[model samples]
Every structure is written in structure tokens, then in C-alpha cells.
Target: MATTLKNRSWRLSAAALLLSFSAQAQAPEAAATPAGMSGQEMLFWVLVSLLGVLVLALVLTGILIVVQLRPQLRKVYEMPTVRPSWSGKVLGLFVGDPVLLQGRVRDEIMSGHDYDGIHEFDNDLPPWWKMGFYGTIAFAAVYLFYFHVADAGQLSQAEYETEMKQAALLVSVGSDDPNKLTDFQPLTAAADIGAGKSLFATNCAPCHGAAAEGKVGPNLTDEYWLHGGEVNHVYKTVKFGVQGKGMVAWKGKLSSKQILQVSSYILTLQGSKPANAKEPQGEKDPTATKIAMR
Candidate 1:
């Protein structure tokens, strides 16, 4: 009987070890996989890893219970009258739920502890709830190790800093907030103005005509202002755009330097009235006259 019990315990231990090894083997594969996995591929691997962890945890838990209760299990097996049913045997191997076996609950119920003819049975926690709680703990440990200890993943703050650095590369030096208007002098550099003209032809021409004359949107060459005519004001308008005014925000599409270039190019067009110019719509800005002089 002792030999039989040892054999059973050894088998259970070996099975648990095998499962542990299987779960560990997946770590190398995950590490070896390319980081540029598609969304669906990443999700599939994540689910598979979680499933393997859950199965390994359950197997370990069952093996622990079996090893701890080896003597009791042997005695139950030797006693024909108290032998567990087929379902009970399966449950004992995996869940170890005493309620599934006949006479198993006798030791579980509180003796003479009845209130109003109600008796309480001390049962183990539900497997799902216990496993879920344990899984969260495991996840937290892995997250801490991955982000803080091993430095394998970026923390939120680190990621934010990295993104800010990347964005800084796209913007020119002395860039100001697009939301706040600043007295930005128009860029007179030939290269900036040329780039601005090219961009305006591509993006703005469909709304504001090719020569800054009015099309679906207002004429950009006129001194009359719908929003404002100052170079700074034009910069703001181009960056944020006017709501319900057909102008789409270009902050994300154009860098700050590019927007400045476009605004400067528009300023250079003052007084050069294009053919078929739209009728001036807004109050004229005296500032436009001063900017045009620059």
C-alpha cells in the first residue's frame, strides 16, 4: 500500500513538473518572436500563454493536495465501503472538492453548530475565484519584474518622455504653442517660402484657390480677415482651424515650422490680388497692412 501510494505521488509530481516545464518553454518562444506582430497575432499568443499558465497552476495545485493527503487517500482507497466514485476520483485528482465524494462532508460540517436548523459546511473556495485571484497576483509580479527590474518594457512616464523626444525632432527650434498666438515674424527665407508654396498648392488649393484667391474657402491674399490677418493669427488659424468654417486643422499634418512657412507665404501674398478674388468677408485688420510691409 505504501509502495502504491509512493508511485501515485511520484506520478503526480512528474506530471506537475512536466506542466511547469511546458509553461517555461513558451517564454523563450515569446522572447524570440518578432516585436512587430500584427494585433491579431499578438492577441492569439497572449491568450495561449494565459491558458498555459492557468493549466499549469491548476495542475500544481492538484499535485500539492494529492501529496499532502497521501496517507488519507491511501486509507480511503483500501476501504471498499468508503471508496470514491468515478466522478469523485476525477474531482479529487483535479479540484479535490470533498462534496463530490460520499461521506466526505461528514468532517467538513461544523458539529452541532446549527442556527435555526441551518448547518454550515466549511467548503473550499470555488476554483474559478481562487484561480482568478492567484492569476492577478502572478500578473502583478510579472509586470513589476518586466517593467521595473528587467527593464524589458517601458513604463508610462518613460514612454511619454520617449514620444516627446521623437516629436521634438519633427518641430523646429523656438517653436511656440499653436493654441496661443505669438508675435511671430514672417519667415523670409527662400527655401521656407518655396516649401510653403508647394504645401499650399497641395493641401490648401482645393479650398482656397491656387493663388490664395477664394474658392470654397475665403481668399487668403486679401487684407480683409475672417479670423485674423496677422502672421501669428494666420499661424493659429492654420494650426487649429476654425470650427464650421471648412478649414481643417493642420497641426498634426504639418509640423510647427511647416505651418509657420505656410503662414509666412500667405503674408507675402498681401495686396497681390489674384484673378476672380472672392469678395472680402470679414473686418479688415490694420495689422495686415503692417505685416504686408514686412
Candidate 2:
């Protein structure tokens, strides 16, 4: 191949010399033709010359690479070949080699158990997984300390109670609770009586008559009562109505303040005469008399 290349070089040099001589000989003729030829014809010849020069350069480049660079490529295949393990073949792209990718490794971390004569190594957990596990433990500790020990946040039960109290507060806006059965008091303002009158007209006027005059129920005036006529007693009676006496319970239907207002309005009717008042039915009370006088 070397002898052939030497001969080819000589032949190519001779051909180039011949081609240059022919070009010199034709130059005068081509120049005279261009004077007669059109502009497109001249341009076509110029482009053909450029393409021929480019093809020659490419051929020379390929021959130089084959002669010089191919020997270095031959040395690569001659170097010592390492028959890397399967894992090394893949992992060596990024890392050099895995620790126990093949036969038993014998440095330090070998364990006792051998599966069919294969040894095991005690490698620690991956750093990232270990860190995540430890982080979870730390988070749990902080949560426990803050909520239960330090009291920085409410626990489930405490949070529930707080929410319930807030709900009760919202439900009780603009009114007092009527659920406490025995914590009764009297309210005597005109606003209280007027509100009570409105409630009574809706609730009790059918049975007791408008203006507390007698009807199906006894009159509410003239200081007489079934149960009792004291303000607190009246409040209780209205809250927990006479069950068998045809009056339904109002505690379930009214607020504590509403019951107070109704009782107050009834007390104001003590001596006001109404037509066809029902005869008084319950015992007279010393407490009632004292309160009425006051």
C-alpha cells in the first residue's frame, strides 16, 4: 500500500503539472471565449472549477487520515483489555465500580451468613434515605413537645372544646340561653314586656286570650296563679309549661331572656281588670304579695 501511494502521488503530481500547463494554454482562448460568451456561461464554468477544487481537497484529507491517524487507532485495539463485570460495564460510565458487584469482596464489612457460598456485606443505608428517616423522627418530637408539653398549640380535645365554645357564642348572639332550668331572674323594662307581649300573642293568646283575659286557660291578672305568681315562678311556669294542663313547654321554644320578658309582662297585669276573667285557681303566697307590693 505504501508503494502504491508513492506511485499514486507521483502520478497525481504529474497530472497536476499537466493540468496547470493545459490551463495556461487555454487561458488565452477561455479569455477570448468569455468576451464572446454570455455572463451565465462564464458563471457556470467558475462554479464547475470551484466544485472540482472542493472534491480534490476532500480526497486529500481522507488519504492523510488513512495514512497518519489509522495507526493510532490500531494501537487502541492492542492495549490490555479489561473484562469488566456486568455491573462495572454499566456503572463505570458514571462511577468506576460497585463495591460487591461480582465475587465475594474481602475487605472489612463481610457478614457471617452465606447463601449457597455467596458472602454478604453490611453496607449502611443510603445517606439520603437515612437523613429522611431521622428528619421524620425530629419532626414528631417537635410536634409532641409543642402541642402537649409546651402548650404552644392546642391538642385535639382542647381544639374541639374551643371550636364548640365559638359555635355556642355565635348561636347565642343577641339572645340569652334558656337551657339553664333553675337560674331564673325577672326583667321589667317596657321593651322586655313589649317583646313578651308579641311572643304571647303568637304563642299563648289562643288559650289564655289576648290581654290575659280568661279563655281555655285561667286569667293571668288579679294576683292569682296555678303553680305560683311570683316572677321567678311565672318564668319557670312559662319555661316548663303545665304538661297535663294543656300548655306546652316554652323553654324549648324561647330564649331565657324571652321567658324572663314574658313573665315580667304577666306580672305587670296584676291588678288590671279584664272582662270575664277566670276565677283564680292556685294558693295565695306571702312571697307573691311581698313581691307584688314592691
lDDT of candidate 1 over 52-147, digit per residue (tens): 766775666556667767667666655665445654454455334444332333336688889998878876565556768999999999999999
Error of 1 at 159 (Å): 36
Overlapping backbone residue pairs in candidate 2 total: 0
Please list the residue runs of candidate 2 whose C-alpha ends up more than 4 Å from where it truly belongs after superposition.
1-183, 289-294
Overall local distance difference test of candidate 2:
0.68
**Per-residue lDDT over 150-182 for candidate 2, one digit per residue giving the tens place of the 0 to 100 score:** 989988898899998887876644323443335
Question: Which residues of candidate 1, in runs, are more than 4 Å off?
Answer: 1-179, 290-294
TM-score of each: 0.39, 0.37
- The residue-level lDDT of candidate 2 at 219 comes to 85
Distance from true location, Cα of 180 in model 1, Å: 2.0
What TM-score, to 2 decimals, does candidate 1 have? 0.39
